[model samples]
Target: MTARRDELAAFLRAARERVRPEDVGLPALGRRRTPGLRRQEVAELAAVSIDWYVRLEQGRVGTPGSAVLDGIAAALLLSPAERVHLHLIARGEAPPQPHVPAPLSGSLRALLNGMPLLPAYVMDFRFDILACNAAASALFGPEFGHGRLSNTARMLFLEPEARETNLDWAAFSREMVGNLRVNQARHPDDPHLAELIAELRAASAEFAAWWDDQHVHERSRGTKRFRHATAGTLTVAYDMLAALDGSDQRLFVLTLADEPSERALRTLVTAHATALANAV
Candidate 1:
């Protein structure tokens, strides 16, 4: 009867309607008037009674326990983010409040500016590049420079140059999409993030496929390789540092993965600095 109940009911039904019987290793028993697995079939897969699932789907039941929700999530093949969302909604907890981005902390800026030798930047939960150092611009190219401040998710999946340069494109692309999925469920009302996600889904087939998989990543650290125009191959290990100020802003710091990469980064930054000074 309540809004939460209604939302939970809709979420469950939609999830159920997206999975085919064969998707869960069941046979295509016959053509039905509707799409997705039947209520009885889902109940079988989730180990719940048909009546119970019907009541839950119709928003006619009280808060179910964790086991029931988990079972239903698995039966529907929900992604990690969707699973968490199901629990929250079915348990009657309010969805997370929309995030209001805060200004970069002094320490985060200092970290970015001080790391002239390393490519560093600050990004919000939406993966929007908020601030970047000269080294980051130099390494990622001018698209990451001022005024552009492109979303990292957009670059890895949308930009042809990024796809060409990033040696671990497939792995990195999945991670970025997964991290964005977490935000998609967490902050459902963010227009900017919603626009970005829709854009990626419409424009990039890889993004569309990865998004449907529903993988969710809260934080990530990994080594990645890039084939730079001048530096041949550059490898870096990066970390996402959570801001200590209780904000969603994260400082991304990249370290050379090897001695050769370190030397190349130094050379790249020096040349970038010189070029900037010369144009002034």
Candidate 2:
């Protein structure tokens, strides 16, 4: 515990030293002995007492709450990843993960549209749909639109239609749960993810049971079966491509592997287009 506190204090000091006063809109005071912002300045930015900040910096303070940590992070101008690390070190627990979606580049959108025959979509770290091509919208239905309804994990677990849409419901649910577990382990402090897991556990008994198994899996590329409302059963091969940007976004493309599946996909896409045109 003492060692942990020492490490936390040192980390806080280093983070404070890296931040400049001008960066946080503070005037540059002439001739400071230290390179970075002073402890008092950091405390003021965080809206905490100087003594309290001093105790925290000297390894005399106990684990702070989320609000205090958040303030410190802001004071230090910590990046998302750094903020998470700070919480872990100080509290020995994961902090809340904010939902800051990275922007989708036009090139990625063009790439998705380029594959007219395939159903492709982009997902953030939380499996939230960021963007999708026309084929994906056709395949997954209109609920696949961006927003709460489009979250892949939420749709799979909470949405009643998923049980009917996924042909192999048991296998598919297990794989999705396992993949989520892997991500949870990778980023335990993410608040949004924790909330998602809690919601799933409360909503689905099957999800709760699967989560208990502590299974971890990373689903990059594989074969998945779906029962389309109009097109019927189809088996497709999928490939998950990682984005070059450091946003932890992945692009998933599903291609029809067989003639029957190809026919179904084409029919689905055509019907979707017709319905959209009629609606417009």
Candidate 3:
């Protein structure tokens, strides 16, 4: 519990440091000793007393009310996901127990196989790639080899190749970090998630910056752009399908919109399939 308190305090401090005084309408009066807004300043902005805020930051109290958490979130300029994480940590429910990895049943694989024109893949709650069709593999890159794969969020933040392939790297990076922020709130204690966060913080400055912002994003249909070395620029629509069972597995499918993009997609799929077939 003390450890959890300390962790929360550190997370709060990191979050605070990223937001400038000017960002929250505070006067940037000359130089400052601290990297971020002072405790009193935060208290003032949050409409709380210096003493109470100090106590919370010091981890003197076990839990804070939602109202108090809300104030702190506002003071820190936390994003929606970050606010949720703050509340979860305050209530000592940030970290969740690890569950067994759900298997990708044959039926699910069959369904993906049937979607010939669409690039499809299955992922666990942690974004671990369970299974992906040839089209999906082609969309990501040829470098993404088979077998036990790393989580998509981890790869996006840490892998140089993924960063290079992303058409709008900054936007995609923020979205990945924001999604991770939400996942952290939902399963804070997952060791895999913790490790991935630590690894990302070490690997990419951009990732570290976004992670500190405390942004959150819900899983939903969206458009993503990729710069395929062979296919040029390709835009695809993505959707997440939740598993019927109680497990947290989700199926992500990507499809092209028009003729040029569709042709590019077909080329990619054909190339990937040929490569895989030759390997087999």
TM-score, one value per model = 0.64, 0.65, 0.63
lDDT of 1 at 56: 88
Kindly report which residue stretches of model 2 are placed more than 4 angstroms away from their true locations once superposed: 1-99, 277-280
Give the worst 10-residue stretch by lDDT in candidate 2: 186-195
* Top-scoring candidate (TM-score): 2
Query: How much lDDT does each candidate structure score?
Result: 0.78, 0.80, 0.73
Query: Across residues 1-280, which tens digit of lDDT does each residue of candidate 2 receive?
Result: 8888888888988998888888775778799898899988877666567999999877677777665676677677788788788888888987765657679988888898898878999987778888888898888877685666778888888778887888777887898899888877665555556556655654567886788777887888888788876788899888889898888889999988799999989988898889999999
* Model 1, span 168-208: residue lDDT tens: 99988888888887876666555456546655654577886
Please give the distance, in angstroms, between residue 107's alpha carbon in candidate 1 and its true position after superposition.
Answer: 2.2
User: Residue 162 of candidate 1: its Cα lDDT?
Assistant: 84
Query: Where is model 1 more than 4 Å wrong at Cα?
Result: 1-99, 145-149
Residue 174 in candidate 1, Cα distance off native in Å: 0.2
Specify the poorest-scoring 10-residue window by lDDT in model 1: 91-100
Using lDDT as the measure, which candidate wins? Answer: 2
Give me the runs in candidate 3 sitting further than 4 Å from their true place.
Answer: 1-97, 142-149, 278-280
**Candidate 3 worst ten-residue window by lDDT:** 141-150
Error of 2 at 214 (Å): 1.2
